[model samples]
Target: MLESEYQNRRKPPRHLVPAAPSQAEFSYTLREATTEDLPSVLALYRHYVRNSVVTFDEKPPTLRAFRAQFEHTHKLGYPFVVAQSPSGDILGYARVQLFRDKAAFRHTVESTIYLGPASTGRGLGRALLTELIDRCEAAGIREMIAVIADSGAEASLALHEKLGFTETGRMGKVGYKFGRWIGIVMMQKSLRRK
Candidate 1:
């Protein structure tokens, strides 16, 4: 589906939707990410890896490792994009990867979005995800799945719900993080109608 077409679809209830980022808070630009952006992207993800259950990685990957991951995504032709400040700082990023390695899963993709700590609540996440969805649909992807760790992540859950994803399943006590058990929430959005 096209971005405009997706925007025209019916949204969930207002209360379920996150408040729009105030104009004063959303003065960034969105664009395709490049290899040079990997350092900043890793930096943003490091926070989540170290302090939050959002990611299960206890230790962040090295720059070379991150670069290899980025290159792999690029080689697969999946979208890897970033939100940038006017001064060239990366505010956030979103990307889509194959949901599974099997040939039958070719039409499905899993999404990952991360924003700088200071960049949250400013609509950058939504913007990045929206673009990712558009690009995925345009590329003939049939489904987008979010394996969201920590079911307590209200903002991330609400954002996906608002964008037409439905809660498909949940896994309990699957991730050990921060000295506690973290549950996973599986949310899915179909980009094309059957």
Candidate 2:
């Protein structure tokens, strides 16, 4: 192989990958993250970072940074859950983060969820979100937000509405991708206050 080609093939070091899927009935569990789970978590995020607009990040985050993100959220007492099968394959993940960095926005937080391509339509999104809201209520989060890329994410929009979120904002031509410009839809849910 050409030296340039060989150089291009070098991969960055990786973290500990989780064990392979375990065969069992259709069951899943939601729990807080651990240092050990970062690799699997990064793997899932890398999928969307590479293949979809599920998140705005143009490049995959390093596993070390991904692990630190979870650590920070955990310290803030927010919900960050990993859904796993009985044998420990991560099917998806969901987490809540501060809506903005300003002190005044602390009560408001943004919600993000990602599912493995093969795991959609099995109701895991609903389960993950239910737990997210449960944690929000417990932690006294006043408002939850979602900024969805508007090539028209129907399923996401539908799910948010079904979960009592309402459209609060929209920006036209705010996101450019796939050789075109697209809009962004922002939705929110108010919790436990008038």
Candidate 3:
């Protein structure tokens, strides 16, 4: 069919991405995540692992594996949060895990956050991250670290900086993924409340 004829046929477009919701229309409840949220959390995370360079994990973790990690963090009294929409959907999730397994690192935590594709640029990340910081402070966390990819994650880096995190250091060409070299930018924030 000619282009004009095809247009006249009124065939619907395919694979179109929906526009992000505006701040006025977007609202969510921020709260601690539960075991029941594991599946949704895992699915949200898999989106990043499969499609984005923000995470170093080239392969998505299994539900069982993610559950094990979540349980460990919960058992250790770390903060795990989910931002749920009014209609009961997990728009994003955040967590703080031990920075290292050593005893000297007990007071330090590494922050991780992931938002759904349609949820970006709607202020959801900032809200989720602020909640994570507040919870980590309440949990007596002295330090919070964010490890972000050097490629295609500038927004995350800027968000961390806007929240009082400083670029502590960087590792160059450490992550090899998607047939290219990627690095990490490490930012840290002191959570010691005066």
Candidate 4:
């Protein structure tokens, strides 16, 4: 299904329903991403590549490569979203990719999320993830999986757990980065009942 069609079918949680805002409240906007957001999105991922093992990549992909990835996900009818400040700064992004190539795996997706370095610890990640899950569920995705990079990634683990994901599996010492072997933790949440 096209994204716009899927969006029209989405039933956002009550808090996100459109209503005039009170002057005392502040809110961030979550919306479908465009190629124009790639530079900022790539920069955010680059920080993790150079300084952390959150992603296994040792080097950041070029902007062209990143744009190709964004397009591929969009073409598959999956959501690629960005969280923006009221002033329009791109604070973070989240998206889903095919969990595997097999035909039977079509109902599942792997999720990725990243925030600008300064945007951490402010609940933005949860907001992005929550919206992603909602959209996926609306589109009839049966499951969402998160392949967290390491067991030491407490914040990521906690965020997924808080959103009803459970640890499903782990591969010890499966990834080598930063001069050590890092483990992969697999977590999953069911989007719908059978």
Give lDDT tens digits, candidate 2, residues 95-132: 99888889999899999988778788888988888888
Clashes of each: 0, 0, 0, 0
Minimum summed lDDT over a 10-residue window in model 1 is located at 19-28
lDDT of 4 by residue, 71-179 (tens): 9888889988899888888889999999998989988999999988878888999999999999898878999999997745789999999999999999989889889
- Kindly provide the TM-score of model 1 when superposed on the true structure, using C-alpha atoms: 0.84
Give each model's whole-structure lDDT: 0.88, 0.83, 0.92, 0.89
Please, what is the TM-score per model? 0.84, 0.82, 0.87, 0.83
Model 4 is weakest, by summed lDDT over 10 consecutive residues, at 19-28
Which has the better TM-score: candidate 3, or candidate 4?
A: 3
lDDT of 1 by residue, 75-165 (tens): 8788898999988999999998889999899889899999999898877888889999988877778899999985457899999999999
Residue 187 in model 3: lDDT: 98
What is the alpha-carbon lDDT for the whole of candidate 4? 0.89
Winner on lDDT (2 vs 3) = 3
Residue 84 lDDT, candidate 4, scale 0-100: 85
Error of 1 at 143 (Å): 0.7
Q: In model 3, how large is the Cα lDDT of residue 142?
A: 92
Q: In candidate 2, which residue pairs clash? A: none
